[model samples]
Target: MRILLTLILLSGLAAARANGYDSLPAPAPAVQSVPAVQKMKITDLQDLIARSDHPLIINFWATFCAPCNKEIPYFQTTVDRYAGSGVELVLVSLDLPDYFPARIAAFAQSHAYTARLVWLNETDADYFCPKVDARWTGGIPCSLFINNKTHYRRFFDRQLTEPQVDLEIKEMLKPAP
Candidate 1:
């Protein structure tokens, strides 16, 4: 009976420790505000794209994706470089709903990520995928660049390097023909 109770207790403790937020480092003071992770549907994203006045990059990523984690610093660097230029970089997280508003905020704060963070509260990939990109296979670390005023648009549904991100930003800023 003692051994069975010990095993059960250990399992419970393990589960409590693994509730999606324990692995992330503790938050730092760098992030002034732990903003609410806005839950966005496909329609909300469409409105964001349509109403953006300046160049915007909506980067779809998830906390569990290794490649997505790797690309964030590169994207953040470019975002900082374009500061005050109205070149916006929004990091749209595809993390499950369970991790929202707190765990995700802690992860971003720990990493000191300055880009705007939002949670894409979407479920069906078939519905939202084509709205972002026709070729999107629902793979993350993808980015969509858009400037509504210029009618400029571009999409990359793969891992992007820093130079590619920089160049993409520059491309978005160009006057459309």
Candidate 2:
């Protein structure tokens, strides 16, 4: 019986080797989970806006808004299209706190989104909304195009098309006149 068991084990090992499965690689060490989205209060956003030296596109989006979802590709393509221009883009998430990090992070990761991602940590829109735009009525799919040095700034609060994005980027990159 002992010899039979040994033969069976050796056969199994030989089969593994024959199939090019020579001893499996060591199991990967356990890894801790980390949120891909960073938390930032509205004030941090304000600071970022104030400090940007190059043209910036700050796109406000959420997991639940259909329009927001629709226009993501426009912005993502803008990211790739303008990568050589030194212009920057950030996708700031406003997903509800209940879903928070998981749904939003998964959305970004699943889509292979390439822009910098952030989650607004504030709950009070009354305080944060105006900081983004004075006329803002808590809209999704909104955006801010800003250049601190050129003092060029524009804000849009509706779904954007690729042509509109292209025009806006060209306008934002125009030399201050």
- What's the TM-score of every candidate structure? 0.82, 0.78
Worst 10 residues of 1 by lDDT: 1-10
lDDT of 2 by residue, 18-121 (tens): 77644323333346233378889999999999999888999988755557768888787976788887888898987657545766766666555667889999
RMSD in angstroms, all models?
A: 8.9, 18.0
The clash numbers for all candidates, in the given order, read: 0, 0
> What TM value does model 1 have?
0.82
RMSD of 2: 18.0
Runs in model 1 deviating more than 4 A are: 1-22, 29-32
| Residues 41-113 of candidate 1: C-alpha lDDT, one tens digit per residue | 8899899998888889999876666677799999989877887778888889877677787877877876767
Cα misplacement distance, residue 107 of candidate 1 (Å): 0.8
Model 2: how far is 71 from its true place, Å?
Answer: 0.7
Q: The CA-based lDDT of model 1 is what?
A: 0.78
CA lDDT of every candidate: 0.78, 0.76
